[model samples]
Target: MNEQVIVTGASGFVGRCIVKALLVRGVGVRLLVRDPARAAALFPARGVELVEIEDLFTASVETLQTALAGGGMLVHAAWYAEPGQYLDSTRNLVCLTGSLHLAEAFVAAGGRRFVGVGSCAEYDPTPGHLGIHTPLRPQTLYGACKASTYQVLEQLLPGAGVEFAWCRPFYLYGEGEDPRRLVAYLHARLAAGLPVDLGSGEQVRDYLDVERAGEMIAEVALGGRCGAFNICSGRGQSVRQIAERVADGYGRRDLLRFGARPDNPQDPPCIIGVLEET
Candidate 1:
């Protein structure tokens, strides 16, 4: 692993895992975070240098260049939480809706490898998708943002020469995730010996453990190329099935409660996406 690296969203679920993985590989990290106190709390190692200040939304290219100078790779994992920031559709309609400006700044500063985190939602829901070979069917605002960002990167290629690889994680779960997240929420509920609430639980989706995602991202950051791939188990599991598995693992079968949670408006008619071939 290269020592000079910058990781945005160091406080996020996937970002934290990536940071930890980089540290494990003996890489020197420059973690970019918006909140200083949050950075201090998350960075357990004495080796990391936290850059807590303005972000892609606020930082100038010159300021970002100073911070990003000489980094071998830039792992772009930060974004605004949708629905609260702008209407989902509006966010996607614009180019560079996310930290794409940050990507430009990274390129300006001579960074090489650019590994980005995206969503499986980038694909349309109508088709029975399987792997990376399908046409994009982005059905939501966030998905459209990600899809457009990839297009932007592609358009900048040839001259840019920035080695870019994007990973569309189908579903991810781990400790320290937001309480509102389904998996972590279930983890907490199961830990507390309470029934987990999942509406219908009929939706079939893929879930990737954050640890595996971290490793894959690290692999791409080092020397990966410009392409998109789905980083998933390639195995579809129903919501109820996962709950049952988690309960079985935790020996809390008696506390499995079934119910409904508010579904996203753009919730695909079904949950499925083409991912990287395993």
Candidate 2:
């Protein structure tokens, strides 16, 4: 707990939560961020070491190693996660390449443990309830790249004497959520007492608060656990169910219009996570 843990993307929504969780546990943290001022305002506390990286996905291995040197643990939560484009973006390739460099740097720095964040999309979507054993059938470029990263690091890190863990989050939502996402959109509409448009609202998913997801990821970093971990709620709720619950908070169920919009044909009917016992 005393050793410094280096966290990339420490200013991101999930990364912010991860850093906060580590800090709450009294762990020293060094943030790899582009904006040190933003990170400073976010943390505003002692024991946070901020190192500015212009672009993590493009940084050289040596540059990364210099920043990572002397760190005992690394939480790699950085990626090209622009809300709408990330799923199909060619930037995923860049991220994949950069992640490899980052892993190499971690190893070069003699880091003891490396924990990386992943996505549920890495699994085959046909399984409504995905377990760690689920076959990887990433349908989108983003998923494919994430699966690729996990597979590569899974083999490479352990062989290099570095403990590795991958935390795959499913349907995380909460503070700092992208406004275009489901929970945020619902809140925006309901708060304004405006009609909220949606699809059939029948797709079931495993949703977890980002804060709790961060806590779980931090636990993996702090403990001796290895392999893939699903950071999810382990319970499936229909989209309609989630919408209604959000509406109830604003006393505006009338504002929800379930069939106002057409559903994405590609969206899976159900995607839930089965927490892996680690």
Candidate 3:
């Protein structure tokens, strides 16, 4: 009779919002956090509990599975954008293994309805010859790892009696996010009255608010059908457009600048995912 839920990456921007949504709906949330102190002390409501992972990025599947046995739903939001992996092909397997373990163990314990967050980067740059669902030919390490996880989960979970729901979120802008990220950084710089040095600004990205995405994810976890859903504003925004919006919102239009640094080769150019088949 325990209506409990477990979430990975609970201390992160989107993870926190998902936890909050569950809590607001009167569901007990068990957050798998690396460091509880790093989170806001007031994050947990009367029914919320924070379960710290003693060995992050190293815990066994059995360990995490047992942790999830008491949950009604699980959301895998934990990702390693860390530089230690160097985005190498071999390291991608390690990250993918950890991601799968969460789902595997959760299923082993009779819990299904696993929600995994995917990125727009997983889509093919052009559908010309490939069309849609084209094997996810990723360029960067992060994209490769995400792609790897998606395929394996789909193939393996069917045998385990677990259903998977993937949510491909577009560019999300919000507070308490890392400053190095594009939207968060631009918001901070514009708020600080500093010149926003941006690239060509032609790179259009699908943007969604973190809070809104969280609500959608919660709904999917409960009643969403199988397969992936594109969780975005269903619209795209360029870099310059985002800068201008932030400037206008913060009233700092004069601080916008262009042509800052050369774009990274790994950075996707105009990465916008189209979500079809609602």
Candidate 4:
């Protein structure tokens, strides 16, 4: 029997892409989802199996072990990411605790590799490229929780003989994204011929297509490397540039209204990631 890769949050935007990439590579996948019907509807891949769990944050160690049986790699992407509420949500603490418990369960279940999805928020909001070795001074509650999880797992997983990798993804734009996100918002407004309320639009961010980001994450899970890896394009582009590009696709650059909205006071001017060579 081939080793099965177990993926949490398999119904999410990025998780769906990861499952597709795994299937394209001829790897079997076991998806741990809260809703079996939803997962089935979202992903109908032949090599995918769905394991239903009521709540990952509260699932028992025994249950997790059983669900993860026969799986060699665990790609943990589940979290409380409810758009506007996630940044400061107290639910981050629950996710932090639960993720740690899941990691322990994976190790106990004889899992070989654990790949966790992190975020650019885990880094300090300095106006430059962030490397894996960049100082981690996360400001938001969400970032703090993710950084704390990575720190603990960095110390714990190696001693347990499990290979671990934390992938910090920068901005992503592509299909199935939340409508409130920047790319989706721009697309919607432009497509509808509504004026796009924008800020200075000069903030530099590293954006990668969601599918490519998912592929990079899957590579991290399947490869032998460990530690933190930035899943990004390693290049910076301004928000205005992205907006203009999207507008070009719709032939509606006139709909974009720069400085129509105020920028977040705490938002950094630039937050690009430095890509590591594979």
**Ranking of all predicted structures according to lDDT, beginning with the best and ending with the worst:** 2, 4, 1, 3
Task: Compare the candidates by TM-score and give the number of the best one.
Answer: 2
Q: After superposition, how far is residue 249 of candidate 2 from its true place, in Å?
A: 0.9
Please tell me which model should have the higher lDDT, number 3 or number 4: 4
lDDT of each: 0.73, 0.93, 0.73, 0.91
Instruction: List ranges where model 4 is wrong by over 4 Å.
Output: none
**Model 1 accuracy (lDDT, Cα):** 0.73
Per-residue accuracy of model 1 over 44-110 as CA lDDT, tens digit each: 7866888865655567777777878888688887765433443274644443544667778888888
Q: Which 10 consecutive residues of model 4 have the lowest summed lDDT?
A: 1-10
Query: Residue 183 in candidate 1 has what lDDT?
Result: 78
Instruction: Tell me each candidate's RMSD, in Å, in order.
Output: 3.0, 0.9, 3.0, 1.1
lDDT for model 4 = 0.91
Q: How many clashing pairs per prediction, in order?
A: 8, 0, 0, 0
Model 3 accuracy (lDDT, Cα):
0.73
Check candidate 1 and list the clashing pairs.
123-137, 124-137, 130-274, 131-274, 131-275, 198-259, 199-259, 199-260
Worst 10 residues of 2 by lDDT: 1-10
TM-score, ranked from best to worst = 2, 4, 3, 1
